[model samples]
Every structure is written in C-alpha cells, then in structure tokens.
Target chain A: MPSQAFAPPAFADVLAAAARIAPHAHATPVLRMRSLDALAGCALHFKAEHLQRGGAFKFRGACNAVWSLDPEQAAPGVVTHSSGNHGAALALAAATRGIACHVVVPENAVAAKLAAITAYGATLHRCEANLAAREAACAAVGQRTGATLVHPYADARVIAGQGTAALELLNAGIGLDALVVPVGGGGLGAGTAIAIAGVSPSTRLFLAEPAGAADTAASLARGARVTDIVPETVCDGLRATLGAPNFDILRAAGAEAITVDDAGTLAAMRLLWQRGKQLVEPSSATALAAVLQQRERFAGLRVGIVISGGNVDPHALYEAGALHGARA
Target chain B: MPSQAFAPPAFADVLAAAARIAPHAHATPVLRMRSLDALAGCALHFKAEHLQRGGAFKFRGACNAVWSLDPEQAAPGVVTHSSGNHGAALALAAATRGIACHVVVPENAVAAKLAAITAYGATLHRCEANLAAREAACAAVGQRTGATLVHPYADARVIAGQGTAALELLNAGIGLDALVVPVGGGGLGAGTAIAIAGVSPSTRLFLAEPAGAADTAASLARGARVTDIVPETVCDGLRATLGAPNFDILRAAGAEAITVDDAGTLAAMRLLWQRGKQLVEPSSATALAAVLQQRERFAGLRVGIVISGGNVDPHALYEAGALHGARA
Candidate 1:
C-alpha cells in the first residue's frame, strides 16, 4: 500500500499552503449571480476555480505539492498518471520550478487535455487505457527517474493546496451558511471541509457527486467505502475512487454527500453559461446542480459553490446539448 | 437631424459617469494572457467588459444616459432603437432606476438578444428590419410616451459613459503603450481617444473594424465619413454608421483605423476562447485581430484592448466555425 504515514491535512497546513502557493496560484474571484439567487431562493457565492491557472483548481494543489518538495527530491522531477487537469497543472508547476515532469497518460485520454499537458512542456508516456497499465507505467517511470510521485488527490500537500480556495472564501468575509463542492477522489471536498471546520465552524459542508459515479454517496449511505463500482459519468474529472485518508477526514468533518444525475449536472452547466455568464465544466456544475435539485435544503441560506474547472472541449459540450438544455 | 446642441463628451464627463454608475456597474477585471502575448509579440491587457452587467460595456453608456437625466425626465422613462446589447443595457439600467424602458427592435434581431432585453423588463416594440423603421418606431414611442431618447452610441452622455471603461484602464496604473477598441458608431473609439488624450496622451489609440464593414477605415482614408457603405460583417455590434461628433473627436485625437477580415476576426475570437478562456463576441475580437493583423504597429508594446460583450448564440458561433476557425 502507498505510504499512510502522513496525517490528514489540517487547517494550519492549508494556511501554510496558501502562503506557499500564493505567488503562483491565482486567488480566483468569488462570483455572485442575482438571477440565479432568485431562482434558487438563496444567495449563491461561486468560487471561480475554473478561472484558475491551468483552467482548474488542480493548479493550487499541484503548485503546493511541487513547492513542498525538497530541492534534491524535486531535482529528480515528478511523475503522475493523469489525462486531465492535474497533469497539466503539475506540468506547469514543474516548469515554474524548472524541473522535469513525466505524465503517464492513457492512450484514450482526451486530445484537448493531452494537448494542454504537452503544451505545458510535460513529457508524455502513452500507456494502455486502463488503471492497471497507467499505475504500472507511472511506477516504472518513478523508479527509473527517482522522481517523486505526486498522487493526484492522495497527497497531503495537494490536499492542503486545494483547501486554500475555501480559505479564501471564508476569509472574504462572506457569511456562507453552507459550502458545496464536487467530490472525485475527495481532495477538494476534504480540503474544503477542513478549511470550513477550522475557520468557519458553523458552515455546513456538502459534497456533490454524479449519480452515474455515485460511489461517494453510496459510501456514506453504507457507512463503508465503496470501491467496486465502475464509473460512468460525463464528468470525466470526477471519476476517481475516493482516497482513504480523504474519506476519513471528510467523514470526520461531518460532510454530507449529494448525488446529481448527468442531466441535472448538464442543465446546471447550461444555466451557469447562460445566466451566470461563466464557462464552467459539467463536473463543476454538480455542486450547483445538487443545491438546485435540493432547493429546500439551501433555501434562504447563503451558500458557497466551487466551480471546479473550465477546461472543456467546446464542440463536445455543444454536441452533447449541454450548451443548451436539450437532451443529448 | 439628431440634436447637436450638447458639447462632445470630455474627460470630466467620463469621470462623472464613472461615479454615477459606480453603485450599479461592475468594475470588470483586466485580464492578461501570457500565451497570447507570446503569440502576438506584444503585451495585451484585456478589459473584460464582457463580464459587465448586461454582458457588455454598453451598460456603462446606458446607465450613464439613464441616470444623467433629471428626476422628472427619468420618470417619463427612456426609449432606444437597438437589437443588441444597448437595448438590454438600457432596460436593465432603467429597471435599476425603477423606470419604464421601451426598446424599438428590428424584426430580424437575434432572438437571444431580444430575450435578454425582455429579461431586463423592457417593453419591445418590433418594427421592420430596417434602420428607418427602427428610428421611426423609436421616435414614435418617445413622442407618445414623453420618454427621453438615449441614442445607443451617438449621445454625449453615452459617449462619456463608454469612456469610463478606458478611464478605469488608465487609472488601473498599468502603463499601456497604446489602446485599441472596436469601432462601430465610434462611441467606444472616441471615448477611448478622449480618455487617452486627457490622461495618457502618449498612449496612441487605434480603432479596429471588420473588413466587411470597413467604412471607418475608408472614411479615415478619404478624410470624410463614409455613410453610404453597407455593412456585411459577422460583427453585428460594429455595423452601425459612424456618428458625426464621434468621427470628429476620433479624427481630432489622431486615432488610426485598421481593418481585419471576418476570417481574421473569427480566428482571433477562437484563439481567445481556447487560450484566453474568455467568451467574447466577434466585435470584441476585432481589437485583438487588428493587433495581430497589424503586428508592426503594436510590436513589443503594452496595449489595452476592450472586450466588448459576451452575448451570443452558441450554435450560431459554432456553426459559423468561429469556434474552430474552419469555414462555415
């Protein structure tokens, strides 16, 4: 098993991560929408992580993880297995530190995402399109280069980095009665829960999940981690199985999991594009979708929602009819 | 003839408008794109007016015109002839003032724009799809309801309001070597010129025009306003005839005009979407297009470009191939 020596990230870790990554990561704006507020019967504050550098909040975690590495450890470079924002983010962070990065990308990765990763100057090792092949390829690379492997959502530094987004929100002085964030491997959700628990203890934490890949919700319902379920969702970013430490921290923080179907997520994404005037990804829309679908729970409350990412293929989004509310 | 009684807008007028609309108008952020800068061989600072209220900088002028009127005059409400951003801007501005707004729209106006205008609570008066019909309808509405007419881009108050955008840029302390703005009726162009002349005289101003609607460029070449040329560009916002006072001010300020073909404009728009991650309209893209098309003029210089608006139909933008830079 991977190292379980590091304790779960804490409020102080998030604070230090914020200071460490402040020069690199953007403090993305918190957007407010009046029409959406009226529609949802709540004052919605959107943390525009989609506008973050590398087009996603992954940059924050990646930057923190890269910076947290010792100079000797960083010199060997870093390796990861991702066909998504984390690869690009890590590549960019490595570039900033003038270190080499190897991304073991599956062959079936989205062309756009691959382009982005390559554009950031990461060396790509194409592997078969499966978790087993990807992990094996990543391990081989790590062994050859003596490069540290920054597990996308399982690393303590990465989790601390992701929590800074919520730290900014809570410090912005907005009274958020609750906070909603999409849960994939639980990095962002766990980070947010820790931030809220530390700074704004009264703010309830809610995790949004795609119904097609609703393992997190199921895990919470069964009171045990669910790992056998196969993922099936348009939210390609949120398909990872929940990390053990992340799940433990989130559960301890009393975070609740809420599932939103793909249709609902797509509809919320369209609303974000049309009314909120933000170009957010479907994975980012799940948080708003959960709040919208469970309107009564958020009614008359001021809630903060995290927009996960903006890196999306426009043609695919349009063809899927997510640009409009039409069924695909 | 349209009234020529009021003096042309001045720097003080822009300042006043800025203060008057400060309570309502969003101080849109100025965005920087490193990749785009590397591509264009210049430092580009984009004023994100697309994120402004009503999805465009038109709201600045609309709010200024609506709020500048005497309490009695404002009570009778405001009327305008527009099938675009100006109509929605005026409607929303009027609504903020708790007054009625009547928009004389052409029948062939984009349905999305019309819906936005209506969503802002404007009473739409549809007329034939011609300039004369729209003007006549607007005049009739103004005459019947005793409402003040807020010309979209020609009025002194409107010009002053639009100038506030440039004023904000100049005041932001970013040392811009030049300013570029898309020219339609020349309100934004003239306002930018006035702002540059008043605050940053060393900063040269350039006007971007689509080659299909290259009357502004032809006018500068001929030393006369070319009113007879019909527009055929995809930049719907920049199709209006140049206003007399606007042309005079722009000329006196020594502003130069550059024409970019629709293909170039669309290419720049796509680059902006993919690299800059902004949902800007074709009109806004023209400024960047001009910079890219006329590389020598702005080479190695810091330039501020106005992103005019984001109100657009996704399908239309896509089918036109502006999203992919392929031929329609």
Candidate 2:
C-alpha cells in the first residue's frame, strides 16, 4: 500500500505555489461593478474561476497534487473519492502528468462529470451511498494497486494550491476591503483567508454557506467544528461539512460565515448571468446571495467574490430553472 | 444627418487593425480535440468570443470604432443601428470613455440587449421594423444628436477591429491549417480572412451560414452582394446579408461559405455546451456546425472556429425546449 501522509502547507508554501502555477493557471478576469452590485449595495469584483480549465477552480489543486508527487510514488498513480468537479479535475490533471488515476464515485453522480473523468483516461470505482463505503473503497483501492491516496481537502498540497486562486486575485493589484467565498469542506476558504491575511492585513474574510446546510456557520457559532446535517441546498459543491484542519485555520484567521437559502442562491445566479453575462454554478453564486440578502454590511466596501465553476449539466440547468419557475 | 459615409474596410486596413486592437481584446481561449472531434473525425479549436465583454465579440469592433475617433470627431458621441450586442457594447464602451451614445433600435429587439444599452447610459431611439424605416430613423436620430455614425459593420474601422480577433488567434503561437467563422454581414469573415492571409498564407478560410437565411451564400453564388433576403434563421445575429463592401472583400480573399439548417446549429450548440462546457450563442455554433457536417473536408488536420456570443435569454431557452417538446 502506498499510503503516505503529506505535510501541511505553510502560508509561505502557498505563496510559492502562486509563483509556480502562475503560468498554467488563468488569472481568471475579475468582472467590474455593474447593476447587480447597485442592487446589492456593494462594489463587487468577481473572480471568474468558472472560466478556469476543467470548468472549475478544482483544477488548480488537482494539477498541483498530481505534479507534486515524486516519480517513484506517482508511478503507481493516485486515488481519491469525489462525485463532482474534483473527480473530473483530478482525472484531467493526472492525464496531463501521464499518470494513472482512480476515482471512487457514488452511482448517482452526474453522467457528464463521469464522462469527463473517463474521457481523461481515469479508472472508476463505484461505491455505495454511505461515507464509510466511499472511504473504505478508496482505502482498499489504494492498498490493492499501491496507488497513493490524495484526500481532496484533507491533503495540504491541494489546500495550498486552491489558495493560489486568492493569491492571484490579491496580486492582481486589487485592494478588497472584504473577501467572500463559498465554504464546503473549508479548503478554499481556509486557504484563501491565510493567503489574504498574509498579504493584505486590512481585508476581512467571509465564508458563504447555504442556509439549508450551513454546517460551517453552526460550527463557527458553537466554537467547534460540526458535521452530519442533511444538506438540501442546490449548491452541490458546498455540501461537505468543514474539514477539521480547515476549521482550525478559519478559526485562527477569525473569519465569519453567512448563509443564504436556495431561493436566494438561484436568484443571485440568475442576476449575475443576466446582468453580468457571466455563467456560474450555484455554489459559486452563494457569496453573491449572501451579499445581496445581507446588503447593509457590505455597503460602500470593495468586495471580492469567487465564481468557483460552470460545469452544470444542461439537463441539470433545465431542472434548476424548473425549480426557479416553481419558486416564481 | 450624422450619417457621414465612412470608407469601407480594405484588406490592408484590417491588417493594421490587427495591431491596433491587440491589447484591448482577449485572444479568447481555444479548446481542441475531445469526444466531439472523435465523432466528427477532425480536430476543432473553438475561439470563444462569447467570453468577450458585452457577452459578444461585437465589443471588439464597437470599442475600436468608438475609441479610434479623432478626439474631436468622437466628441458629440456615436450613433449605431443595432438593438443587439453591438448596441450594448458600443453603449458600454462609449460610457467608459465619458461620451454620449445614440442607438436607433427596432422596437422588437431583445429586452435584455435593450436593458444593457440603457444601463450603459446610451440614449435609445426606437424605430419601426421595416429596414428602410429603421435606416431612416437611424439617420434622423444621428442628425438630431450630432453624433458620429458608427455603422455596425460596413465601416472600415469596425471591420478591421472585428478582424483583430482572428489576428490574435494566429499570433497566439499556433499554426492552424484552416479557419472557420460564422458569417452574417460577412464582416467577420472578410476581416478574419484578411488577417489570416496576412499571417499564414496557406490557411484556408470558410464561412458558416444558417440555411434559413443564407443571403451571403446566394450573394456569393450570384457574384455580387444582395440584401433583400427574408431572414428567418433562429440565429438572429446571422440575419444580416453580406454588405456590399464585405462581399467585395470576400470575393478578393477567395473564401468559401456554406449554410447549415437550424437542427445542425442546435446539435453543434449542444455539443459545445455539453462537451466543451462553454456557453455561446447560436451564430457562434454555426462555425462548428460546418466542421461537424462537412467532416470529410477537414479530416486529420487542425481547425479553428470562433464562438461569437453568449447572450441567450433564459425565457427563450425554456420556450425553445417547450416548443420542441410540443412538436415531439
């Protein structure tokens, strides 16, 4: 079994990654203020990661993780468990590095995402619905094939690489008074806060959570990490509970989180699409929804929002619109 | 009347435009070879102009024309004859420069595009649906406002600026064997062919047109330009026939043009949205449709296609699906 622990990425390590990935990763243009901001009463600078390769920011972490492995350790390939963007990103990144990849996927996972992983030449391992089953399968696969395990968020390299997104934004000469991001397992937010804190001390960090499944907010309020709530938000990317290490990082950074309902998220998504003409996913729309719903707090401040990805299936989009129509 | 007859764009003028608009426009990402290519048996590289500001590549010409005016000729503001992407783009760009703008629009243009122009602080002049009536209304508005007339395509600077898109693609460190672009007024094709020929002399140029309104094809076949086609293509942007000057430029460039039905455009659009994960307008999809439908001609070599815009209304999309469902 090629199960080896990875080292935690320091703030310095993330800065190093900002330099390393600068060429490969898109600076992803920041959209200027428009009518939506006037409605929300905030000066918004949207970092369009939805335009990122593989249709999401996950490609950053996935690419770094694959490229970081030593030749000997990587020879047998890598394994992880994900049902969405992360799976496709890792598969594509592995293909780029000419290494084998194994994705442990839940059966009901989106067909398009699965097609992307397969198209990138990765092997798939189907698992049961339970978390225990997914983890067990990943471990067994890693052991049987001597492939190294790359825990999506729990791994330090992935977190550090994800932080480079924020690093790129700040380095783009933006002096944001507040930074808002969608929080799922807290990898992106935790790493972003660390990056922002190190480079721009004046900036405040915020995490956006879906009200239907706000594990991060509950965890923040309880002064401890929380988990295992039934999440019903349409923002599928942010359904995971905060990872322990990420929670600690967020606590240490003194970041606060805001939650918005499904209605609010979809409305924000529609507004951004219509006014800004930028297509993004529900998870990416969460921060804008938070800002819109809770406007007074963000007024008169330069705010940065991360648009995480745009890989929603066309059918899923029709279904989402059906949900929106029902709400209307 | 502010309709001072502007010189039509010449092949050399487009070459110079390749230099002028280089810094202002995006090289627009190009994606190549995947599942769709496997099915079509030819490589496809999509130049995603839909990612351009104002949600369309029309911004490039509008920006250059608005900005290129001798600070004095540009002072009273600019007038255009569009109720679509060009109207919005010119409005936004003119607003950015702190200049006034006048848009003479047909009463029935898309509301979203209308809102965009109004949002950018451009003065709108509603006109009748009849072409002669619209042109007369545009002239009246331009004359009354003392604004410089910035025709959508017929003008030399506009055509040259539109050509800049293909120029950047050729400059982006890749050597493609052929270039495919959606043809409307033949502005983009005329400009793009000139640009491509100036750089890669061997690269063949082809134009894609919707069969419902294949005015450019009819005009080319008859060895002259014709504008009196009862346009019916769902690709609204492709409704314009080849302008007189544009047809002249195309004839000189030795370019070939083909027309595809709406079904082919939709299939290509779906392929791009699903497999390429890029959102674009139907006119943009026509280029890929040409490649997909005529796979035998482009087998085994590299090809580049431009996706022109991404501003489809959500309601229209729902309506399209509804109409298809009812028919089925």
Residue lDDT tens for model 2, B55-152 = 78887888778778878778889988887888888897797678999998888877767888898899989888777887888788777777888878
Winning model by DockQ: 1
- Model 1 per-residue lDDT tens digits across residues B1-328: 1233768988889889999999999898888777789999999999989888888999999999999988988888999999888999999999999999999998887787788889899999999998889889988998889889999988999999999999999989989999999999988888888888889999999999988888888888888899998899999999998888898898898899999999899889877776676667889999999999988878999999999988766677777676774221
Q: Model 2: which residue pairs collide?
A: B9-B156
Residues forming the 10-long window of minimal summed lDDT in candidate 2 chain A = A319-328
Each model's total of backbone clashes? 0, 1
- Candidate topping lDDT: 1
Report i-RMS for every model: 5.1, 6.5
Model 2 lDDT per residue over A1-328, tens place? 5655655678897877666666566667676645666798878888878867777888888877787788998899989999888888888888878899999998787776788889789999999977899999999999899888877787787788889888878877868999999999887897798788778978999999999889999998999988878888888898887988888888888899998998889888777666565557788889999898888899988899988887665456665563354211
The DockQ for candidate 1, computed on C-alphas, is 0.30
Error of 1 at A272 (Å): 1.8
Determine the backbone clash count of candidate 1: 0
Q: Assign candidate 2 its CAPRI class.
A: incorrect
